[model samples]
Target: MRAKDVTGIIGEEIAAEYLSRQGHEILERRWRGARGELDLITRDGAQLVAVEVKTRRGSGYGHPFEAITGPKLARLHRLLLEYCAAVHRLHERRRVDVVAVVLSGTSEAHAAEHLIRGVEHLKDVS
Candidate 1:
């Protein structure tokens, strides 16, 4: 795999591990298609969460969470709609989360922070 692809995989692994440690049951990883890509899908308590993972090399580029701008969130929102329809009927209990993963090339170095219950539905998409 390419450098970025490898980094992305590592990032996802970190995110999954963190979620598990936080009492979340991972349901899926990289739930994606032509519409867009969702990094992780997990359950927190009684609610299902759709997560977007953003991995970065360092702080030079900017904060990983800041990369998740409004347009990106909108796409994630639509993808969440697809996931909800395919997996379950209820929508009120679902939420969107952002996982910011910081990667290091050195061994024994990795970090991930899951932004729980982040992102809200837009008032108007049109």
Candidate 2:
């Protein structure tokens, strides 16, 4: 697969691990709907979290969280509702999260070495 795609996959994996460590149960990864995609869907207690993962080689453009604009969040919200409806699921609460991963290099070694520097989990974004 392409380097960016690979990075994204790694990012999602890392995000899943991070969430698990934080006591959340991973419900899905790369969950999709007609509106958009959710990088990770997790259950934290009674809440359902819809996560968006952003992976980049550097922050030249901006922090990964900055990439999620108002419109993108709106779409994510719609997609989250669609997901719930599709699965006939309900939660006491719901939220949107963003996981940003930045790697120093494009290689796997660099990704593993510099993960701590690049990984940031922003919760309850919406």
Per-candidate clash tally: 0, 0
- Each prediction's Cα lDDT score? 0.69, 0.81
Model 2, span 44-63: residue lDDT tens: 99888898988777767678
- Residue-level lDDT of model 1, residues 21-125, one tens digit each, is 888899989897569778888888887778777776755677677787889888887887788777764664777888777654332233233223221222122
Model 1: which ten-residue window has the lowest total lDDT?
Answer: 117-126
Displacement of the residue 19 alpha carbon in candidate 1, Å: 0.6
Residue 14 lDDT, candidate 1, scale 0-100: 75
Among these predictions, the greatest lDDT belongs to: 2
In angstroms, how far off is 30's CA in candidate 2?
Answer: 0.8
Off by over 4 Å in 1: 105-126
What is the Cα root-mean-square deviation between model 1 and the actual structure?
Answer: 6.4
TM-score of 2: 0.87
For model 1, state the Cα shift of residue 34 in Å. Answer: 4.8
With a 3 Å backbone cut-off (N, CA, C), the pairs that clash in candidate 2 are none
